[model samples]
Target: MSDPTTQLTVLFMPESAHGPTNQCIGIGKVLLDRGHKVVFAAERSWEGKLAPLGFVEALVDLAPPDPGATDEAAGQFWIDFINETSPEFRKPTLEQLASFVQPTYQALIDGARYAEPQLKAIIEEHRPDVLVEDNVVAFPALVTSGAPFVRIVSCNPLEIRGPGIAPVFSGYAAADPSGWEPFLAEFDRTHQETWEAFNAWVQEQGAPPLPARDFVHTSEVANLYVFPEELDYTDARPLGATWHRMDSSLRETDAEWEMPDSFAARPEGAALIYLSLGSLGGADIELLQRLIDVLGTTEHRVVVSMGPRADEIRLTANMVGDAIVPQTKIIPQVDLVITHGGNNTTTESLHFGKPMIVLPLFWDQYDNAQRVDETGYGVRLSTYGFTDDELLGAVERLLADTELRARAAATGEAIRSRGGLRVGADVIERVGLDHVRGRG
Candidate 1:
């Protein structure tokens, strides 16, 4: 039970992507159970979802309304953009800095500007004691809300950098610094102008300036980042006092998933693999089709997350999937995971004690792939270039390696025992309580 005087009206503003929204939901639910009032200031597309989870939904759209359309819901701007730019995924990560990275950050900056006024209105109305944002880019409205602010890095912890550490978005190996300079040079070449302009805009609006080399501002009260402890870069880069690490804040609300009959009917002892490229990566029909074709030939049954364009790809006889599925519920039941190496999936597979074949597409996906591969927690495969033999061999090799499986299981055990959700809730609640009492 929460203290009567400590009850907080907390607002969570997460990125529209499923990973950040879901991570925030995990921590929000815990705070709700502790007698705090939790509210989510999300985009209009999330209308019916958050309310059912017992949160007060404050809807805001990142793009302007269309005059003619019945549903002028603006979140589709990102989905459409990703699909249109799918060709850039084939480029080397360094080259993609100009094509994919800059454009993506530009969109985020535009979104922050568009949503600021609406967010200001919501903050005024709700008067939350604490504000939390799970995003790569910072929003000035959140920082200047006169409440304790928290930042959740649902992406790879490499987003927070140190001098000797590898650059954030580069997919460079953890053990090597050879490529760091070139990647940093490329990142700056493409990102410096936009980042500086955004930072200036933030300060002009009365918010603290963003940290150097970071697009998001670190919270002075409390900041939490999600990544399994075993795979963290603590030895190389130690964080400050305000920083806290949560293994993964997996939502506890997902309904228990029963394996479909097709998978259940597979021959005994056959390995089961879960394939998801996330909502955005899943947009690439050609890539998904290629993966489906290769996995179809295998004896093992597969469960695929078809993503936003599920209908475009037909699953093989040994597989079953829909546009949306219970990822957390299913991860525990699968023997292996083939993922796009999104932070959520990478940490989640670890939390469930499952090994992965990290097929990173872009952004920090490369960093995650390298981290897992080098740590022996998983294998990293080429997303666009993996051959049938490479895919088939990885599956066979991972399933056959008992020692690696045991190590992954052990890491999962430690992470689950740590309970990142509860820890994050505690920190958030403390920050909220302390601030309300003028102690923060």
Candidate 2:
């Protein structure tokens, strides 16, 4: 429980992306409800978005604007990068280490380095009691600012390695470690120089050194990852006392959604499915169109969150879509989901008891997709190579599987009833307050 009396000023620095920022919003709401101050530190592109939600927005640019660029949004640099390297996503994960992962980390490292001076300035300006970050890389200024800091792992929990566990980015199965060595070899080969340079720089700024193969430093005070109990991998490798698992951290802030009259007017009992590739995945118009064509032939009605290229793509007669949808609101109303296995969508689907056909594109998405498939909560198919039947069949089968649906419902009830939102908020409150008092 929160003190409800001691109102601590807290600063949140999330990677300027929707997934991590959304997770922060969920927990931030809890703090707001309890009368604590919550502030979100982000780049200028994100200024207007957070302030409306009652969070104090502290905007700091990671880099100056490009000479010719006009439109701006959170993680715009990454959005452009992902689109430019879309072809690399088609390659095997092993091959991607050199082509994609290394460069991605390099960009993140550059951003972190450039933002350090600004981060230091922000800390001085805000003088927060606690600082929290939901990011893949470390920001030394947050740790060195003399405030208690918390780490939120909104990615797959496997990102945190342990004994007997598979390597972080590899989608290899836990029951079999045969593939782990090659993946680690590739990761180290591609990232060792980059990691060492960043690690050295991090230590120079008075923060702890990152582990050999990791980018972010674990918080000594508290660390939290979003994952349900049934799906967590603690049996293989535990993160010990300071770490906690949040079954799901879904926000309550999404606008209410209702089935469009076109779909609502359909005869009762018609199956409804949602197709979303997330922001990055949605930019692949060709792939989205192919999926839409196949799903159009089914007896199902579809709703699509089409990302940035929605205007360029054609939709089927049975489909309605937008560049973005009220995803949390839409999930509960759908029987099935065709998703890119992004962390937010995967956890949200499980939280709503909706079965999924996961098409993983890159990063920990592969991990989420494989876990859902192996754990029986959903099915996974290759993003680039699945045949129309392979895609449609998974949808048909999941929709027909009463046992799986029942298990999903029960799991979702447990996840919902316990309220991971509240759990996350409570842990943060306790950790922040305790650490601050200990310092005193």
Candidate 3:
């Protein structure tokens, strides 16, 4: 319990994207409602989103080659690259993946450099008692600011590193003991190159050296995983003492949405499939059209969130495409979700006991898709080399499978029993207050 006499000021710094931004807002709302002062530091454009939440906002300027570029650009680049190589998986060699991620890495380094002074100014001005950071690109700035902070793992469980676990980017399911050696070797080689480059950049920026690891892991008073433990690689590999697995940090909004008139009047027996490719994945017009064409033939009512490219696509009577939709509101009404397997969408679907057909494109989406299949709650489809028949078949199979829905319901119950939002807030308040009191 918090002391009534003391009100802690908390600052949240999340990378400028929907997933990370939403996670921060979920926790920040809890903190604000509990009588503490909450602030958010992100790109200037996000101020509109943050303003409605009533939190004090601080905007940071990311450095050049693109001055004032937001963190969303990194994901946009990945989307553009995927589209350029569409209809076929560009399985870049390890060296090529390293080269591909370099510009994004440099952008992070530059952002951190620019953010250091901005964070220092905020710290000096607000004198926040604790900093809550979405573990994306702000670690260097947090460490240099000398502020006690908590790291939130909004993506995969890459922190639990060891020999038996599969590499995050490989999209491979957890392997048997004998089968993991080769994957481990490749994991080490790939990350070694990445860390060498990142650490070199850190030195150039005059920040403290980041510890070398197979993936980005930071030392913190408490590291919160905003995902169920069931999605983790394997129970055999223990998450060490410092880690805490919390329920999904999805904030429930009071705003309500009704189904589109066309969707509402669809045949009663038809299955409802909510198809979203996330903010980044929806950029591929060709891929979106292909998916729309394939799903249109099924006896399902398809609702697509086309993001920025919604106007470019044509829809049929069986399909409804919108530039944006209240996904949280719609996920519950749908029978099945066809998605890019993003962490936010994956967890939300699990929370509502909805089965999914996961079509992963890049990053941890592949890892999330693998877990969905491994957990028996969904089926995984390859984003590349899949025909209309394959896409239609997977959807038909998932919608018709009774056992999959049962598994999804069981997992959803387990997650809700853990006390979703309260579990996360309790950890944050206890650890954050302790650190402020110098008892951590």
Candidate 4:
């Protein structure tokens, strides 16, 4: 039981993994240890990921309503809905944005309104002293203002600046790159519009708008899971936020995973490489087949976790060698991770200190791959249909490079020594609990 005087209630909106959602879950784990009553308040999709952590969940049906829908019908509809809705917003015309921003922002505000009755009931029933939220769920900030508690924002990867680590903030509008200089100008403008919409929503609800920096700058207690020593945020004009490194204590591997039975026969000296295309992209069947064909010819043992869509690609016997395995358990045992630069996979590879051959498909994957290249730890593949010879060359270069391997190991050690889980827990505790007191 928590100390009655020190008990807190933190409401976080975690979307799902493959983005900032899982990162929030990691943040939540630390709060759980403090005996704090942390409620993961978000779309119900998050329940599967949250249940394992022993945290309580309060789901809001953010999904659109459809009466008389079957289970499969709902899944199919949502997948298509997400796919369609995603692209439209990715490149909205200024006219479209001007017309739609208010309604879209209002819908989110409505989400808070819909949530209000339930939240009010809960609060009235069991008075939580604080509400900590992800900046993505901006409406909640407006909904819970001036309560007998504090409101703190937790920014993951921290937001964009001149040049350091570019933590990709989702729902941020992309610039219309019709012209290079103008596009650059619009980047700032787009961010301003985002803040404006948020501010407009809050102001209408009787709460003060957040500082311009509040929506963009690193929070007073932000958790940058990446090792600070390894980050090159020299271009980042920081806003006095305390930067905490990732915790090593959070890295857990099951003892039963000593070695998969399939690896027992593989020649002990052969190098092993792990490949994954991440969750969203990397669905190139021909590309995957080509990789299998090339990897089979090499002395190195190759493992591929083709993701949920792996079966779509057919593989031959050589590609099926004992070397291949799913990432669920294979990552800890590999020497190199050939991946699509998804944040989670990259972070995990870094957590293990494994060098990488990053093939970013789209979105932040490119940014992540760029970070890997800039940091001198990995090489990014163009993925523009590299010929067999070109792909082979890149693979050979990475495999033979002792320096890359050493840097990766060193980076991993640095991250591991920093107490990844504990440090994260401390920062979250500070944000979720201590920040409330600091409000005074």
Candidate 5:
């Protein structure tokens, strides 16, 4: 057993995405309060975000880039890569979808190579007891660190795989298991190609080959899932014993934000709808404008968070548009949420007992949207080829459906009943300490 007073140094290697970063913050705070030293190996921009939380931040460039480029160059390379591979530009075919994600898999390879040296330096300097990794990217770096590592699934439970389990990327529910074999076959092929390419790169770097086929595989120590079990497809297919599901890792924020004047001043009995496409999905100006136009015509008062593209759009009298809104503050007041199916947004919306119309853009968003629809608490709309009428109809249905509202409320209560942040921290601390003592 480890000394109770010993302050173990815990390190986190989270992907640069907003959802993963936010989750790191949530878990970091809990561990910090438990008298542990927390450090984050993230991008330079994350320094400001971690500083206020009292975490020691080691800035590293982990962005996936083109071959033979410096980390700084890789940052711009990723921007260009995203521009070229945005889901808005891709077709709905399985081949196109697979092609669209190839760059992401390649980026993980690039990021691992880019981050390995910095991660090694951090490990040598800090001598962390355990490394907690968000199971999206940076697997190569984590494996090379020579420290016990814990995996956290901050998004959809993709790492939990077994027979009869639907493909992680497929938006289909587990109930209809028929006719999915071909898609799963194609998905497996794509996954194998990604794994082979990454393995070859790791070999060239003189790193040991990964034991698993993909980056989403669970860690041997422990894998912490931040989502509730009700939202997962865990019926017949059982996850590994090391896998643990805790409640949502949503951190409470004290930032004060009021509803926009247009929304606040809406006529009595008008429905209020909050629309956010997350940080990445908001870049599609065409989709944003189409959503704005359609929702603006509805009797409901709409508030749109355009993320970085807020300045490019125009808002009408019944609508409000901003670069970013305090969604935590707005979610409880709204009757329904229109989102791009990002996990944070999906779980937050459900936690607040608000119904949603999910327009999944890409990645785990599709799976999350599928879960929402399957649970009878929300509706799903295709981000590609969705007409204004379809968007309006989905929103209207969610808003009017009393049964869906009841289901959402019940689900929210169930999720809240499960210990949230505290439970997640307990698991992390226990696994991390056990690993540290075992190493000794």
Candidate 6:
């Protein structure tokens, strides 16, 4: 049973197109069902995904006008567009509460103003005892600037963990925190700038500047890792704050969700390898062509989630086939995943005990790949000068090495036995209650 002392209100934002937005929603649902008051500060586009999940209140339209349908395809085009047109838009748009990107800052401020009246009303109406928020929108930083509430930072694996965890990048190690001080400093610096910028915006609206990342280090701010604990990640041991592992609502197989009959005819008993560059940026055509050339002849049956962007690439005679589904569903069935090393996707693969071959393109992908490489659980390959041989070599190594497979499986088993949901629930309850007790 939940504690009677404190009521929690969570502000969630799913910012990026390929981001782990649903994971945030799933965590919110778990809290909401437990009788906490939760509110999501998200994009209008996420409305359809959130409405069914029982979120009645939201501070909506946190992004620009839908990038239009032209940006609907998540692949090389988007990556090229981001690089060509606007490089800073990717992380800042998602991470910053008030971005420095010109009109973007103005747009967010305006959006905040539009959302503030409604958000203020909800906060006043609900009188939440605590607030949990994604670091993306900095809603916690904005709304509870001086208010008293436990602030929990919600994020996927790489964003939250120490070095060598979930392969987001390579310098941090789980066993040793001091080893990655430089990277940690950089991470803190990035957050500091983001918060300072956000504080400037808040001050512009006549609100006081709150503390920086140091606030998070204190008991008042807690860190909650949202990926399933069953995943073999680096430095998963939670520190002073609580840790919550979210269960993927994705069932192994659902009768309603349909795939092509030709693709789904029968399970290929061989080691099932799933390939998805994720929904964000990737060299769709080149990577797809390379995969087709290599995996087509392999002993493993490959299933590719083309992610709508690179659907045109046809598999050669060697590959079994491919399908397009959320990786949450696909990773469970596959034996290994070849990905662009997005933290969420990597964690999903590890959650299911599947080994991975990380081909990072940009942002946190390289970081995630580095973690995988350093840990010996997987190999990280460069896509910058990728060739068919390089792709084939990585795939072959993952398939041939029994030790890596066993290690990955062992890690997965350890995570499964840890009671992911229960631990997470306990953390949430404890932290939320602690906030109330502090008031007393």
In model 6, the runs with Cα more than 4 Å from the true position are 1-11, 14-18, 32-38, 57-59, 63-127, 140-196, 203-221, 226-238, 241-270, 317-324, 433-440
Local accuracy by lDDT, each model: 0.88, 0.87, 0.72, 0.54, 0.75, 0.55
Q: By TM-score, rank the candidates, best first.
A: 2, 1, 5, 3, 4, 6
lDDT of 2 by residue, 184-215 (tens): 98898999999999999999999999987899
Top-lDDT structure, candidate number: 1
TM-scores for all predictions: 0.96, 0.97, 0.89, 0.74, 0.89, 0.71
Better of 1 and 6 by lDDT: 1
> lDDT per residue, candidate 5, 204-227, as tens digits?
655566656455435777888877
**What are the per-residue Cα lDDT tens digits for candidate 4 across 1-440?**
23335656665554333345555666566666667777766665554656667667776655455576665564455445435444433342332233333344445555654564455554555445444444344544324544332223222243443423333422121222233334334444545666677667656656556666333223333534443346434345353445544533333322233454455456755667787775544345455567777777776666676544465666544334222243535777878888877666777787778878776554445556666776777877665545777766767787678888787888777776766656665555555455457555
lDDT of 1 by residue, 2-95 (tens): 5666679999999988889999999999999888999999877788999999999998888786675443224355458667887888898888
Q: What is the C-alpha RMSD of each candidate to the true structure, in Å?
A: 1.8, 1.6, 3.3, 6.0, 3.4, 6.2
- TM-score of the candidate numbered 2? 0.97
lDDT of 3 at 437: 78
Q: For each candidate, how many residue pairs have backbone atoms clashing (under 3 Å)? A: 0, 0, 0, 6, 0, 10
Worst 10 residues of 5 by lDDT: 71-80
Ranking by lDDT: 1, 2, 5, 3, 6, 4
Prediction 5 TM-score vs. true = 0.89
Candidate 4: stretches off by over 4 Å? 1-7, 67-130, 135-137, 142-158, 162-183, 188-195, 210-228, 234-236, 242-258, 282-299, 316-329, 431-440
Model 4 pairs in collision: 246-420, 247-419, 247-420, 247-421, 248-419, 248-420
